[model samples]
Target: MGKTPLHLAVTGPSSVVASWILEKDLGLIRIEDVLGRTPLHYCASAANFDLLLKQGASVNHVDKRGMAALHGVCYLGASDLVACLLKWKPRLDLRDKTYGTPLHCGVISGSIDVVMALVEKGAPLNAADANGNTAVHVAAKLGRHNILRLLIQQGADISLQNTNGRDPEAIALDAAGNVGILSILKHKRQDSPESQSILNIVDEDTKASSLDNQVTGNDSPDFLWDEDSMGAAEQNELMGLSQSANDDLYTYEEQQEYCSTTFPKPAPESQSNNGFGKAAFCLPR
Candidate 1:
């Protein structure tokens, strides 16, 4: 308990070292480093993560640093680790001492995959840290237009001022010359729950109508049967899919693509397509 054996083992070249320590004491999985990081906190490999979880590691355990293994995994930029942790259904919007949520911590790590994972999990896109830094603030400060765009499309509040009173647009505009990022951040609003509810209802209606079309095998004007539209029930099923155990954006993207008939499609391209290039992405925050 004097040191984080799991963290050591995970960072060490020998997986067997971790295996041996864990075998000696399964409780070691819960042991924290001086900084309060657990073995789960140090895991960079999915195999180690799976093994620890199977052995009773708690995904929600926070380290002395005020972050849980879930946030730590996101910070590690391991898509596999992020995928594995979300299946455990860790609490969303849980803040550290600094009030940083997993969404905040994840965005700092440069893993858009992890960011997408949190977004799909319905993590509050508008939630801010003690410093009033929303995920958008962090992304914009770092010039991560892709993450910024994703957060924006998912209804993140870009207009919210941080502790310094700068909105996301101001942060990005001052830090970089990317006017496109500014243009994207400038467009936002308070999404009404009524609209979301209407979306749900419309999805249900689409399903019913699509089912009729399916039975008739007749092309219906109500929806496109191709890459765009699906039955309402199936669409609803996809909307609730964030909690599913299956990993990655495949299901989320599939849902977005299939439900385009109801929700307008937002551009999902990375900044590279806009001439900014991935090479310019800010280093992990």
Candidate 2:
């Protein structure tokens, strides 16, 4: 019986529908369903919050769960959306009923990009929920190794204890299948963190060990060659006929661009400052 035209407008398959529906009654913009979710909530979850902000959608209204429309913005991993919502200056630190801040939502969404956005926007890194669990705690418990590392790098207070008196590292140890997370935590105690070596060739006797596992291991698929199809004198690297073996795998040099951070800096937000469901998206954008 409800969703009113305004609720549907919030869905915004196109801005035209929202604008046209609003022409009939501007009041629809503030309408809420039985769930207490407003058009702005849907707008934050779907359409451009910038477009909605300009359209006069209320950003403060929370649904039954006490989550502001800004919380829903985490559902979208797009940096553009992050930039738009940051402009609104919504309470970046607002908590949902569970006390989970926007950072927690982004972490739950498992979108590394989204997590970076919140961190850059000055969202609380150590804010705890009703359970005394912080985003770092959640990252470690969930085996989000990369996210956990970034949080710690940003000074998330790995020593912070939850209600149970367990720090993020302790939480990581308690959570099963978190060996990788545990290892990263352990490195923080060491004076020098050791990075895995890429590749290098020594003497001819040890040359075979330098190749990739695929090339040297027995599990590699059979490499077929039509010996008769080619002249015996021609180059036959696969056949191993050449006197000098050219190492194909490890001999190649890495060509990736050098960069300090992954996710591009979060828009115009300050350098110092800084999802929604089981997946990065809870509902269709």
Q: Best by lDDT, which number? A: 1
Superposed Cα deviation of residue 109, candidate 1 (Å): 2.8
**Residue 139 in model 2: shift from native, Å?**
0.6
Residue pairs in clash, model 2:
105-275, 106-275, 109-275, 119-274, 122-274
- The segments of candidate 1 whose C-alpha lies over 4 angstroms from its true place after superposition are 12-15, 97-99, 187-285
State the lDDT of candidate 2 residue by residue for 142-255, as single tens digits. Answer: 788788888889888776765555566655554653667767766764565555211221224343232222132333211111132334443232111223323211111110
Clashes in model 1: which pairs? Answer: 36-64, 207-232
Worst 10 residues of 2 by lDDT: 250-259
Q: Write the per-residue lDDT of candidate 1 for residues 74-190, one digit (tens) a residue.
A: 655667878888888888777775427888767877789899998898898888776667888778766777888788778777767765555665556455444556555544432
